[model samples]
Target: MGQRTTVATTFGSAVRESVGSSLAAVDAELARRYPGDAGTRQPVHTVYVPADVFTAGTVREWGDRALAALDEHAPDAEAFAAVLGLPGELAGPVHERVRAKLEREPVEDLRIDFEDGYGPRPDAEEDAAAARAARLVAEAYADGTAAPYMGVRVKCMEAAVRDRGIRTLDVFLTGLMEAGGLPGGLVLTLPKVSYPEQVVAMARLAGEFETAHGLAEGRIRFEIQIETTQAILGADGRATVARLIDAGAGRVTGLHYGTFDYSAACGVGAAHQAPDHPVADHAKAVMQVAAAGTGVRLSDGSTNVLPVGTTARVHEAWRLHHGLVRRSLARAYYQGWDMHPGHLPTRYAAVYAYYREGLERAAARLVAYTERAGGDVLDEPATARALSGHLLRGLDCGAVGTAEVTGLTGLDRAALERLAGRPAGRGF
Candidate 1:
């Protein structure tokens, strides 16, 4: 494939380039204003709605397992504590029965098929299954009042037969949206993005849908999953991302790392043998680097080694999880998925902790320097060094908001002026 595809766009280069430049500058300003974080953000922390949730069954086992997993990792477990019944927890007289019924009731499962003459994905039965899950999603977010930021990884339109799968998602999601089925953000997750053109096609579809539905938000955001070797290979990773960014439809929220399939593509000996294996780490590095400057967020693949139990198993796993998360975070990669909700805290802990400390240290240093510079062209050697230091910290926090540091450190505008070093002798 050619490095640059000759795709025609309605938008002009000047406008797009200008917009892109303005966006890039704004990102810098945001870092300076907010936090010094220049990291990738994959639409915040979330869970994958499995396929089984929508299937009617003795969901007891699944619920129990999910709860057990939550008991270990879900950072917001206290909110859902009633399920576990913590102190002052009210389960009611028939809590178990109620719980059982709730569990038995089908939910939106992206993995399994649901009701309907057909289901959620593999056609008829699959579409029906998807609708049920959609309905469940509506109810979960308050009677279709609002849907959380949910994205469905529908079957890609790769094969001739699979065209219907994508269409079903279109029809299904359209109906759902029409019926006030909106959560936080609606995203279409594309499984394997081979080239930029695929993104364009999807974006076009999204625009069409948005226009047809008159969605309050006239944008169909997309999350691209990079699973195949083709996506990750080639040292010219930056070129690949530039294309995606250009072609990204209205909304391209994130670029997710697909571990298993990626490994498969890489021809790794054992899938789970060593995620941090040099090969894996290198690939991750490429993904992180490519996403660094792009507006698109990056999400590392899941840590497949789920904890064995609820008893400090997470803590044990933390060393490894923290290692990978910290490295990714340090490299400016944000937003990683938690296959088991239990791992949520690890994600939050690592990210929050990293930024918290990193920001604090950066702020303290920057604040101390402010006492002397006196508003000079931020180009003075000292100023350059300070700016560089602050920028590094900014990258780590996924922000570059140096001003944000002032608020945190209790340094005022005056401090910034002094540190900025007042035009080198414009008088005091």
Candidate 2:
């Protein structure tokens, strides 16, 4: 038996007590900066529809069009997989899920665009459109047909259209309130954010809205569109995106990349502009790092390449979009923008294949790590968290079945979520 000995220590509680307030300040700052994930389902993509063209049937129409494109172009699992170069084993499951997803919930997130998509209109016309958008969106949600997340993308805070944008936003939000308070899925976007002051202004604007409507403070949140060179690198050579997050005052939900606008701002020729371009990658990389632990999600920008015309042409465009989507997924950007109904097919195809192809392996590794069983590869807590996140994301988007995930990991949804560090009872 070994005798128990009193251990001698050099520094004790005195040192901790001396630095307590400083440590408390640091803890508060960390909490403000990196609040962790919101424990909610982040949509796989956002669909932008011109405010003038959106209607009650817009969502259903998009789904039908996407299904039609798939039927006409790549009708079978093998054919669709061939187009996207997916693995053999993933062909069937991915195909089935893509079809089911398109039919069940084609557009997870939709934005009524008042910016480029609905470029400058007469003041009265824009006002009317914004109000109409609110009405239709509210009705759709009431009928249980709306997307999981829906919002309006107002113009920038630039001097040219600043007042117009503010007026349109007021009209839309007021209309939503009149319709029957704001829907739970409501979102707002501030585009072409070039300065942190602009984000601060937006936060203040939202605060005013909350006050006017007698809602709780900080109830209005928005996304900032990263489109300008200055947003990535400021005049002082600092990373401006970090400041944008801080300026948001906890009202920023995401940072969405604006593909063409940003590419052109960087002096990239129109023909050479794409999400995979080096300049685009650099900007998004900066955004990814700035937003990493800030509870702010990153959404990749859209492609201008449309899948229209002949079958061969559609296939080419599909391949292009699919490859780009796969590249973004590999880089950890789970969401992007879909410009048209035709893009939806490949969007789901790419997302499904990405998650499905890696599901079993991730599940196995997660199970091993959680059970503390010896395996060929040892994974730490961080890697296990990543694995759990992968599965949860797959489940959220319908790319992976709950039953299959449970069978593989021997952990149900609640267990997996706890392992992922999400607050309990917050289902995907």
Over all chains combined, what TM-score does candidate 2 have? 0.98
**Quick one: best lDDT, which candidate?**
2
Please give, for residues 226-342, the per-residue lDDT of candidate 1 as tens digits: 776666653554446445545764366667777666776777766463445666677667666665534466777667776566545655665566567766766656556555534
What value does the lDDT take at residue 11 in candidate 1? Answer: 83
List clashing residue pairs in candidate 2: none
Stretches off by above 4 angstroms in model 2 are: 1-5
Q: How does candidate 1 fare on TM-score?
A: 0.61
Report residue 229 deviation for candidate 1 (angstroms).
1.6
Query: Model 2 residue 78 lDDT?
Result: 98
Q: Least accurate stretch of 10 residues (summed lDDT) in model 2?
A: 419-428
Q: Please report how far candidate 1 places residue 104 from its true position, in Å.
A: 24
